[model samples]
Target: MAQSHRFWNWIARRYARMPIRDQASYREKLDRTQAVLQSDWDVLEFGCGTGTTALEHAPHVAEIRGIDSAPKMIEICRERAAAAGCANASFDLAAIDRLDQPDSSLDAVLGMSILHLVDDRDAVIANVFRMLRPGGAFISSTICLEGQARLFRQVILPIGNFLGVLPRIHAFSRTNLIAAFEAAGYEIEENWQPDEDPMKAVFVIARKPA
Candidate 1:
């Protein structure tokens, strides 16, 4: 995790400056996520790179807290929030697995493009489940490394990680991802893949039983 933190920190500036890969797809995700958010809800977005999505959702929720392991990422998030005047949004330098929130304390948790990056995704899912109130949602966008992208995870990424040139990436199929959420007791509310290509990220909205 520490090594991943360093890698992210090193790329934080470039990452913040980069534009969203797919604007239309990103908007669709934001719309779907907003539909699940209540005006008075409290949200937490883990691995919130530069806090773009968190800030976008801030106006719809009472407050949204963004957390990331990289200090530079968190710093950039704070700066973006301040510049945008998004008072309802805040950021912290922390990892989701290490976050100590009281059980059933939050209204929703967002894990956009983050689950596969973690060391123990199941544990993180379990922790998110425990943090949300009954009927709360866990929204996430993850790249499931299967089909065409399988080689990148199985071969290229391994060599890059070994050479200290790339961060670690976990490879799992889309079926495996859905099963993990269901296994953690979350009911699937939405499962979407914007592109037919296996390289596209899968967006999911899961709810805890009320």
Candidate 2:
């Protein structure tokens, strides 16, 4: 985790400068997410790299706290928030498991392009479930490699990681992701794959039962 943090910190600026692959589709996802957010709600976003998504949704909520393990990422996030004049959004350097918020305190939790990188998906989901108020939402976009050829995902991705060509990936199927949410006591409000590409990114909006 330390090594990962250092790497991300070193690349924070470059990562921020990179262009979104599908701007139109990404905008659509943001719009859909913002549409469901309430102005009085308090939101938390884990693995919020550079705080882009949180900043985007900041205007729709009363407060948004974006957390990332990388200090430089959080620094960049703060810089961006300042540039955007987003008073309601803040960034912190913290791990998901280390979050100290009270149980049932948040109105929503968000994770975008992050679920697939976590080492313990179930534990993370459980924590997120614990943090939300009843009827709160867990909104996310996850990159799933489960649709790829088993040999390539299982063997090639590992080799790529060893070669430093790719970051370690925790391949998850869309079905399993939804099941994980349900197992954590969330009701699936929406779930769908946004792209037909082999990377298989999935968007999900799940609500805790009131």
Candidate 3:
């Protein structure tokens, strides 16, 4: 785990230093997700690192809570939110498996690049299902693991695995992802692969039946 932490520290620093082109990709995804939000909604953003997107959409929502498991990430996110004057958004250091909110209280749950890192993705999905009110939507994007082997797995991730790296858990097939969502009690609303991004990620929107 120690080596994993170091490896991730480097990854985080690298992400923090991403060029404008890379940052644009993040912006496009955030914008696409935000465009679907309703005006009177209370949102919960899972795995909200640094609270950047939460801050970006705070002005349009009734309330937004940014949740992350990493203390350092939460701290940075809180600082970023305050700096951005995002009065409607707050950051909490909490894991998705152990959500602090009441069941059926949230209107929407947004998770960007999160489930792939979790060992118990199904549990997280189930918990999110309980938290979102009936008729609520869960918006997310996940990497399509089948295609990643060519670019990231074989070409790159092998180096990390050699260093006794942490297990980078990922299982993203269109069928598998939709099945997981259905298993968690959501009905699929929108599912597609946008060509603007190169990460092989697929955008998905699902709703809890009323």
Candidate 4:
């Protein structure tokens, strides 16, 4: 975890400057998430690098807390939140597994491009589930690396992470991901893949039973 933090902190500047790889898809996600969000909702967005998504959703919700393990990432998030005058948004240097949000408290929790990088995705998912209120949403956009590039997941990614070129990645199928969510007692409200490619990000909005 320390190594991952250092790697991200080292690259924080370049990461902040980099443009979104899929602007259209990003917009669509924002729109979809906004559709389900109420004005009085309290939300959490873990792995919120630079606070873009949380800040974007701030105007729609009462409060949005963004957390990341990297100190530099949280610093950038604070700067961006301040520049945007987002009083309802907050940023913190924390990981989802270590977060102690009261059970059934948050209205929504967002995990964008993050679950795959975690050391224990199921535990994180369970923690997120515990934090949300009944009928609350757990929205995520994850890169399922199980398909298309089998060799990349089995070989290249592990080698890259060992060589300090990539962050820790867990390769699993979309089926496996959905199964985990269902096992955690979430009701799948939305499951979408932007394209036919299996390697593309899968957007999900899983709701806790009300």
Candidate 5:
């Protein structure tokens, strides 16, 4: 947890100066995300760093809540929400295991660059399933860790980041992930590559069956 805290502190700093590509990607993703929204949906965004996508999507919906494990990241999200005048959006700092929301409270849940950060992916999915109302969905974009990103995160990049370790978050194939989500009670709706190599993050939308 200490490592993650320090690691995300650096990430928050880096996000403060995101490149044009990063900013553009988030903007485009928000459009794609909004296209799938149900009118008046209650949305929950996981791993919402600095509320980038949360604030972007909040105005397009009735209610949005963003969660992150990093305290500083959630603080940045709060600050951004205030700056954007997004009263419908809120930010919380909580581990996946400690999420305190009521059962079946949300209409949909989103995980962007966030699932791989979890140590137990299936358990996280199960927790998400428990939080969503019937027929709700979980949208995610993930690092497969089978591609160049693995080499960079495991070998080339510093040894400090385990979020990319092959046997854990990055270990499963896309098929395996689908199966895992299914096991956790979601039916896969959409899955596709949205970027280039090493970082060819794939997006998925999985819904809880009614």
Candidate 6:
């Protein structure tokens, strides 16, 4: 995990300048996520790289605390937030499991393009569930590597990770991903694929029962 953090730090500048490949799909996700947010709600976003999503949703919520394990990522995030004059948005360097929030304290939690990178998806989901207030939402977008080319998943991805070119990747299916949330006691409010790619991007909005 330390090495992974360092790797992200080394690439932070380049990562921040990388363009969004699918703007339309990203906009749709932002719109859907914003729809469930209230101006009085407090939100948390894990793996919030460069703080783009958090800043985007800042105006819709009372406050947003975005965290990433990578210190440099959090640094860039904080810089962006300051540049944008987003008083309600803040960034911190921390892992998901290390968040120092009380249980049932947050009004919402966001995870975008993060689920597939973590080693323990269930633990992350459980933490998110523990943090949210009843009726709060977990809005996320994930790259499901299940549909990726067999050679890439079985060969290239592992090689890339070994070479420090990529972080860990977990392959997950849409059905099982939804099942994980349901098993964690969240009711699926919405789930869909935003783009038609071999390795698809999935968006979900799940609510904790009130």
For each candidate in the order shown, give its overall lDDT on alpha carbons: 0.92, 0.87, 0.74, 0.91, 0.76, 0.88
User: Candidates' TM-scores?
Assistant: 0.97, 0.93, 0.83, 0.96, 0.86, 0.96
- Candidate 3 residues lying further than 4 Å off, grouped into runs, are 1-14, 20-28, 154-167, 196-198
Q: Candidates sorted by lDDT, descending order? A: 1, 4, 6, 2, 5, 3
Comparing candidate 1 with candidate 6, which one achieves the higher TM-score?
A: 1
Q: Write the per-residue lDDT of candidate 5 for residues 75-124, one digit (tens) a residue.
A: 89998889888899999987766788899998888888777667778888
Q: Kindly give the stretch of ten consecutive residues in candidate 1 with the minimal lDDT sum.
A: 145-154
Model 2, position 56: C-alpha lDDT score: 86
Look at candidate 5 and tell me the lDDT of residue 159: 50
lDDT of 2 by residue, 101-141 (tens): 89999999999988888888889999999999998999999
Error of 3 at 103 (Å): 0.8
Tens digits of lDDT, candidate 6, 42-155? 999999989888999999999999999998999999999989998999898888876788999999999999888887898889889999999999998888777667798899
**Alpha-carbon error at 165 in model 1, in Å?**
2.5
TM-score for candidate 1: 0.97
Better of 2 and 4 by TM-score: 4
How many residue pairs clash per model? Answer: 0, 0, 0, 0, 0, 0
Candidates 2 and 6, the one with greater TM-score: 6
lDDT of 3 by residue, 37-115 (tens): 8789999998786676778778778999998765666777777777777788988867777777899999999887777
TM-score, structure 3 vs. true:
0.83
Please report the candidate that would top lDDT against the real structure.
1
For model 4 the local lDDT of residue 179 reads 99
Candidate closer to the true structure by TM-score (higher is better), 3 or 6: 6
TM-score sort, best first: 1, 4, 6, 2, 5, 3
Those runs of model 6 whose alpha carbons end farther than 4 Å from true positions after fitting are 1-3, 195-198
